[model samples]
Target chain A: MLSIKNLHASVEGTPILKGINLEVKAGEVHAIMGPNGSGKSTLASVLAGREEYEVTEGEVSFKSKDLLDLSPEDRAREGVFLAFQYPVEIPGVSSTNFLRTAVNQVREYRGLEPLDAVKFLSLMKEKMKLVEIDQKLLSRSLNEGFSGGEKKRNEIFQMAMLEPTLSILDETDSGLDIDALRIVSNGVNQLKSDNNATIVVTHYQRLLDYIVPDFVHVLYNGKIVKSGTKELAMELEEKGYDWIKEEADKATV
Target chain B: MTTITKDNITDSLLATVHPNGNSEAAQVIRENGFPTTKHEEYKFTNITKRIESKIQSFQQAKPLGLTQQDVSKAMIKDLDADVVVFNNGQFSAELSSLGEGYAVTNVTNSEAPFSIKDLYDDSYLALNKASFEKGVFIQVPKNKVLDKPVLLLNLVKANDGQLITPKLWIDCAENTEAVFIEQTVSQDEQAYLLNGSVEIKTASNSHIHYYRVQNQNNEALEVNNLLTDIHRDSTFTSFVLSLEGDMIRNNVTLNLLDSGCEGNMYGLYLLGGKTHVDNHTNVDHTKPHSESNELYKGVLADTSRGVFNGKIFVREDAQKTNAFQQNNNILLSDEATINTKPQLEIWADDVKCSHGCTTGQLDEEALFYLQARGIDKKQGKALLLYAFAGDVLEHLKIEAFKEYCIDLVQKKLGTNF
Candidate 1:
């Protein structure tokens, strides 16, 4: 469903992702873990088509289409979603209104009819239960005074509404409590199907316990140094990234 | 008619003055002449230059034969209010429709209940006082709340260099409640000048809401002076929405006369092209326990310019006063400019007064967030701008008017949702 060949990217003339090669098939989950400043979030941002990140070398393909050729909004319309690390606070736009626009635009891009207000409200009510989000919170300004848990849950709610083909969760578990993590994981687990994919980008293996991944890759110094199965996550959780760094440094020497 | 030059504009205006004009006002204008850019209050706004170029052929031109269809086209659809139409600065009795609980008369045929002493300082006020021939006097009796609002629709249809002065005096007695919407619309494509003034008196324990809408043509130069005297235990709220104009200057002053009075001033200006709109508001807290709040927002596109000068004064005897003022602007184009100054002068130590101003472009991160949610760049920008203006629009109490203003703002921004 997604492929990256020797992808190299930078931000403001500073190289961050260098020669990152990854592949994910349909019906599978890929976890990319790393320590602080190891380019874990940078990879997610580049995949989401953030304007500040300049793709310097190599190419990325999603569903056999050139992903880098599309804008951020077009990327979302083409079934690519990025749950932001920090959702912005828009003071005057309500969450319901924001989601309605997003859903309608995505539908239009897919050559589908837009949902009316009554139908949209019913779909929202069903998704609210899945994420355990409050209707009152959705009626207020988008993430204006929302708690960290509520914000994360709202992101999941939006994901459920849009139903993207490839979902990239970047540091979603960083600010969540135990209960929120459980609910967010449950939402992602339920939305999984045979023809969709998800990339879980995190700093720790704590989220891997809820939504287990088929593969785990350790990123260090803008390059993926090691790749293994789910047991590698437990191995790194027991020990840390220091051993991986030592091994990567020895290989470079 | 004499050719109205920059040096002789004042003389030309005063030549055919009304018989009941104030002599002192004429003397003030004759002595000071029109204000130049060197004047402190008119530093940023070159009103005299605009008027001089537009008033060269100033004359008492005949009315442009405006009809009921023209008046109805400018009216708010489904608005059930008392409508009073003023065409070319003259009251159109045949076009006006009055309801119960209020009396409307010609100011020239009756004595004004209140004096315009405190508002006689400016040159525009003096110009309005010296040359205004047709004015309306609207009175609401004590303890009576009107069944509906009063809509003063001023329609100007002058294609020549005509000068029109429209005046209004609203007298709301004690224990009454009233809402007045003063809307100005132009019906021509050529140059003209509209020097207008409205004086409002809200007595003790009364409440009044005044809304001013300026959606004139591109060739119209408007100078509106609104003076409001709010008495004991009363509340006065005013909203000014400026959507279109060539050169518009609004001078709004509110005097809190007695104790326990509250005043609010809210404004929004969405301008494009070479349009210029200036809003200058002053709130005077004279008695104890008075409060005033003000917020004005502007969105300037193309080479449009906006100016906001808000002043709050707390006198020595006005202890326990709470005053707050804020002015914010978004310059969409690089050439668009805004000069905002919020001043608070508190002579009383026990008062709480604060003022702030900010001018910048819209937040890039917020715009990106909306775009990431699948909305296009233009729609995302429109949504963000509308959100930025929501704070001022939410203060309107009338639902229909609020929706009407929202529609106007969306149309101005080219927003679909």
Candidate 2:
């Protein structure tokens, strides 16, 4: 349940996302594939309400509410989750504590009482299985001294805990080994429901193999130049974004 | 090398001398005299300003804020601790109780064989003796493992007048185990000075856990020192959390007297406004096979300042010694400053010793990531600060106290997160 029209955003007065538009319905997974500096991340960041970027034009709506007007925490409360390409290593904040705060914040927004500690721990145990994360890891600081794979897996753990209505994962599979990719993908797959949506933002097409997207859009120069089925991801991966770049040049000519 | 030799720190310290120019403690300061900057220990933090700006009013004012009930209420949950309450610098029997297998008695002004006979430095130690109100002498008998942590709650409510000296001595006997928790707090905004000393002696095979919490009033200033001696195979853990007050200085020295002795120290200091905190720690590896590890972290905001100088000295005969020390700090405002030094002096070739110190701002990249995840700047910084302080907080062995420390730090940061 998301809609964007003529989206124009910038950072420090420099144009990034210009005249871009996209729409996605509930329960649909959309993959935005773009080469470097194509404004894919800016779109994701603007949607999550990062303050650095100025929304010079266009408006976004989530379930018909003005998205741009909401604060970051408000967006988080409204079930907008972002999986950072590089997860932050929050020293001294145990994984369990971070997730608990996030889950309770989300739950509070929905008018739900915070989960009791016992109930919370059990829920964590159940979720940890989805990502193959160890209990010992949960006991330590969030992502501190964790391997790249562990950090990626921890992101899925958080997504599981918050159970957001929409999750925008930016390169969740960038550093994962095949096994970790399978585990992370499986986690995202299990957390998906018919009432929510997903946006997979990545530099590679391998992640789409496990949780196949409903629409594969090739993004170039702040605009989605082409839209196709899952085969499009395979085609882009096989020949690379050069084909998309060439096609954009041909259009300009 | 003489006792309390005067140095350059005292010359530069002459400016801030107040109107009266003295307290019973200041008289001691003038007599015992200020140690120069060349004094190895006082090198990093220039305490001259503290000496010259000394307010005579602090030493005479009666302690303010807390009553006996307030202290008893704050004792550790379910702990059968020997409760000693010090209101300002004076010990209150009406507010104290000694636990089983232990004896807690006030070391009154008239007490015999008082170390008052062999004084250390000026008013810092002597003021406690000249007009000292109360002190505790704790003795845990041989081989007894007391089941609870001793509670020493030093409350300085508020006062207009002078200084409060809280004094303590603890002797945990051979093969005995004990835990001690001390809290220094003030509720009123009255300006005062606190000079405190806690001396501990651990016998062979004994285990001691010491926790110190400082949450004094915003107008208060304090200088506290602790000397701990560990015999063979003894273990000592000391953690200090400094949160409030205008100025705070802490000195902790651990002397490992026998082989197999161990020392673990972790401290967290959070300062804002014009508050200042200086911590000096010395871990001495005297006997062979002794080990010591120390980590102290601070978060400074506004114009507040922090100083950390930790020294690990391994004597020539102390072979196989393992000593590690780290001091890290974060400054929230550009005006905030941290002067940190971690020093290692190892004479034994077989020893493993390393010390590191870093002063920095919070990671911008990490902050951006949190913001991109829909967390605002304030919440993101709070998360990182908590994470920074979390490194030391993790060493807390008690769950409730650990949570208490985290909450206290968060409140000090003045953020809802």
Best by DockQ: 1
Query: Which tens-of-lDDT digit does each residue in A1-253 have in candidate 1?
Result: 8999999999999999989999999999999999999999999989988889999999999999999999889989999888888989999999999899989999999999999999999999998899899999999999999999889898889999999999999999997889999999999999999989999999879999999999999999999999999999999999999999999999999
lDDT tens string, model 1, B239-358?
Answer: 999988889999999999999999999999999989999998999999999999999999999899999988888999999999999998999989998988887888988988888888
In angstroms, how far off is B96's CA in candidate 1?
1.0
Estimate, for each residue in A1-253, the C-alpha lDDT of model 2 and write its tens digit.
8999999999999998878778989899999999989998889889887788999999899989999999877787788888878788877767787677667766776899989899999999999999999999989977999999999998888888877888999888897899999999999999998998999998889889998999998889888888898999999989999988999989978
How much DockQ does model 1 earn? 0.73
**DockQ measured for candidate 2:** 0.42
TM-score (0 to 1) of chain B, per candidate?
A: 0.96, 0.86
On a 0 to 100 scale, what is the lDDT of residue B123 in model 2? 37
The lDDT per prediction is 0.87, 0.78
Off by over 4 Å in 2: A11-14, A118-157, A173-194, A205-212, A229-240, B1-32, B35-59, B62-79, B108-123, B126-134, B157-160, B364-383, B394-407, B410-417
For candidate 2, write residues B371-414 as lDDT tens digits.
Answer: 54445568667877877777688887666677777778877664
